[model samples]
Target: MAAGGVSPGGPLGAYVPGTSLLHRCPPGPKLLGLLVALTLAIRWPEYVAVPAVALFALARVPPRMALAQLRPLWLFLAVAFGFQVLAAGLGTAIEVVGGILLAVALASLVTLTTRVSAMLDALVVAARPLRRLGIDPDRVALLFALAIRSIPLITEIVRNVREAQCARGAGNNPIALAIPTMIRTLRAADALGEALIARGIDD
Candidate 1:
């Protein structure tokens, strides 16, 4: 998020340079494949493993790096799996959790191999057909870009807030963490909006 001093393969967001098959693949096809795989994973959880493994291998993403990306989601995954187990059964829990992990892993691989600029350009091109429907492809692409960039920014904000809370002995108080994070996030949004307007992207 600092734009420097962060690993390209870090859990946040950055492109990892590689010469693997996935790295060589164009963003358009990679995105299409991701969409198909995600749909299939949702429909048939067992199918998730196949593509997950294949994608990691093709991307030449180290197992450690892939796991690093998932590390942050462990708590959410555990809670989801546990809730599913209590509500349904272990099999159902596995399917649900597996689908979620597969989705994240697949999406992570795409971002890992594809540069953000390249991905945004690909999105603009992909959205071109929607121009007939009164949609602006450039704006649509910009939205996606912002969403992608915001994830890491928000993550960093949360981390900083949590650290400050702990230092202040707030000890994981949800309100303490949430309020400051929300304020900081809003300020960030305001700054981003102003910057856009200054650039004449007010629309």
Candidate 2:
């Protein structure tokens, strides 16, 4: 399989299971705070932002996971920032992208420290006011749960597909690789749905 490699599970899916203070904090505070922090990041342009972002990132995850979380986006951030600098000289671009990085890192921190179930519950509760309408909070929560769970799940599929191709001595053909992976992923999704049903999560 001499074609290309995939990235690690991005920070959202790179949650390290642990019992740090971050891990112990109620999911609600983290979720609510994330919403507020994101609002500030988007609403305010002139504030010195990097340190706020850095502090947020450092507070939620282990040092090692923090480093790993930055791995996937490093090159992309570099290229985007580099283009910005080239296009408009350095200063403003540096300031802007640094703030952007913090926003991303903040999101990663929330996803990293919080469990998937907790995230699902938060989404459901937030949308609960819509329960009077046609919205089904439980189903919506399940959808979110599936969405978050799918990140690592799909990452695993790609990993397994690469390993399979290596064993079969097949060269890296995107179509061939993708087809089998897609089939396997659909099967996994169906199985997951069935399991949820069995557990009454779909009820």
Candidate 3:
């Protein structure tokens, strides 16, 4: 997606415009809150995961939609938590997974409520002090925006690739799926690079 163009929301995990309190909240505060929530989740007691789950509730996104954002991670989470269980124990595993999920949910909430431009502006403002280090805040902010915006685009691409493969009865073939997905992803990246260069952002 271009910096100025408004892309449609993604399947399942895209932002839904709303007038709720979380939707009205400023991106800066929401970002700070996410950081704090993540920190607490990582370092605090198991009970802390409770309120972390509550944070998603405060975001007011539908339960099904929120689950959609998380469903993709289940396989990864399962493997990771399984390791924790073997190395530590069930209780420790639960705490770790719960904390991680809470953190992810909080981040998803921020993305859902905040606009891409608003997020970039917030990042630029936060990066102002880094000027002493010879960093370009605008460039850094643009990079951040591109990274966030690409998530939905990439998700959509994968969905399309999977559906295409399934329609051809090749869905079970990893090679078929991986090859096209990689080719498409690289093509998209090359086009994005060309667009950036054309706009005089070659650096």
Candidate 4:
């Protein structure tokens, strides 16, 4: 997503330029730390707050940028939290929602501090062992790169669809939103597939 000078337009996988300790850290360690933190948070959701605060502080990312990472997910999180509250209780809902938020925040921190290329290189190296199982490390890394790139593309598509709907006073219509979003997403996928084929990546 950091390729060229184009911004991802959303905070999800966008790298923010900084010179903090986290930024100086290598992508492999950051990724390992993220996996560990997420595992711990999932196993003990009650303690998610501590790491959430610590990571954000350590990353030194702008407050607005950090918070923006959660903006798109808030609605989905809220709904899931409400379901948890009804199925279990307030404490359970808090733990569930807190863990989810912590996971997102931690992953965002890694991406924000580490460059996309660095992460892909680290992944390729880490996946080398999988070559024994007939898995191509470069292809695995390329797949990850495409997945990361798609997130922002999908986000932008949804945003544009929402804006257009709002302009037509159909902002509250889920059907209107879902239909166009799906259509656009499919078109984008087709274009991407064609591009890949043209580059001899059809296999």
Candidate 5:
């Protein structure tokens, strides 16, 4: 509904807002950190060696803000914890949860600090190094914007459709929900394509 906005799960997934030190880091390194954290997260022992002091540092971030960003993934984290505890034990469960959360915390820091426009600029700059692959910088930027913004927008549409369906007591039928959901999704896509063309995305 607004320009320079966010999407729910795609590129705009889990945007955290803040003006912390972590926010000003360059996009390349910030993205690199996410990659490293993800690798460490899959191994619980990695969580323990992360240095208590660093964990404490992350703790300094506003809990309410972090919690809000983490909310979307809470169910998945809980499920992973449950699985680890059942399949492994309390120790493993704690390890998995800590590792995953550590990654989340770092990512949250990046998002909270960086504005969407800044992120787009960074991505465009980073992709400049990829022009050797016949990629257009403008197109790449548009792609990033669309992918990221689509997340929040799609989530919004889905939420609206779901609520309307449930209000009519049709929430139980998967087919009913899927049909309308798909239709709405297609409509959104068409609208986006038209908007992009209008903005000269194809030319």
Candidate 6:
């Protein structure tokens, strides 16, 4: 991607700015919506998941773009569905996968609509009550922010690693990709930890 260019159909959690109703909503409400969507998706029938997934897409961007966000997981989802079908039945597989996809979609919506700073602020505020129990809200909020921000970084690392492997004619080798990816991920984590310590934020 070019400087400041939007990545084409990045997986969920990549925020896209928009002028939709969801974008206008506060983070707290959006978080609540995510919770509600997840609850309904998990506790209700499999069919309910379809709408949940759709709503997540429609709220963020066009349906096509939303689907693109999920493209990366298509293989995993397919494998999971296949396993479920073999273990149980087609209907059960559909239900299980649908529910998972729905949850993923709803979560993507939350991150897409809400800015990272706003998310951290909301988390800090929400965690205030826990401060009485000796929990540091700021630390908790930082952890959440790190987790969200790390998703895209990790994705990029994987993409770069795959490309490097492909250049060396190892593109089709899963082991070749996995080994380097794991090593790079660990190095990245170590670097991140070192940076945090340097900034005196490792607490």
lDDT per residue as tens, model 6, 1-203: 11332234443236677878888888998888778778877788465666765666567576776676688999999999999999999998988888777777778777777766677687789999998999989889777766666766788989999999999999989999999999989998998889789999855
Tens digit of per-residue lDDT, candidate 2, span 20-132: 66677778888788788888877774463665646545565567777677788888888889898999889967876877777887777876777765666767788888988
TM for candidate 2 is: 0.60
User: How many clashing pairs per prediction, in order?
Assistant: 0, 0, 0, 0, 9, 0
RMSD of each: 5.7, 6.9, 5.8, 6.1, 5.0, 6.4
Ranking by lDDT: 4, 1, 3, 6, 2, 5
Runs of candidate 6 exceeding 4 Å displacement: 1-13, 57-60, 135-203
Worst 10 residues of 3 by lDDT: 4-13
User: What's the TM-score of each model vs. the native?
Assistant: 0.61, 0.60, 0.60, 0.62, 0.60, 0.58
Q: Write the per-residue lDDT of candidate 4 for residues 77-191, one digit (tens) a residue.
A: 9999999999999998988788778788888888778876687787799999999999999889778877777876888999999999999999989999999999999999999
Candidate 3 residue-wise lDDT, 74-175, digit = tens: 999999899999999999898788877877876787887776667768778999999899988988977876776776677778889999999999998999
* The 10-residue segment with the lowest total lDDT in model 6: 1-10
Q: Mind giving the per-residue lDDT tens digits that candidate 1 earns over 41-63?
A: 77876867885897788778878
Which prediction has the highest TM-score against the true structure?
Answer: 4
Better of 4 and 6 by TM-score: 4
> What lDDT is reached at residue 202 by model 3?
68
lDDT of each: 0.83, 0.73, 0.79, 0.84, 0.71, 0.78
What overall lDDT, based on C-alpha atoms, would model 3 receive against the true structure? 0.79
Better of 1 and 2 by lDDT: 1
Which residue pairs clash in candidate 2?
A: none
Residue 158 lDDT (model 6): 93
Give the Cα-based TM-score of candidate 6 against the true structure: 0.58
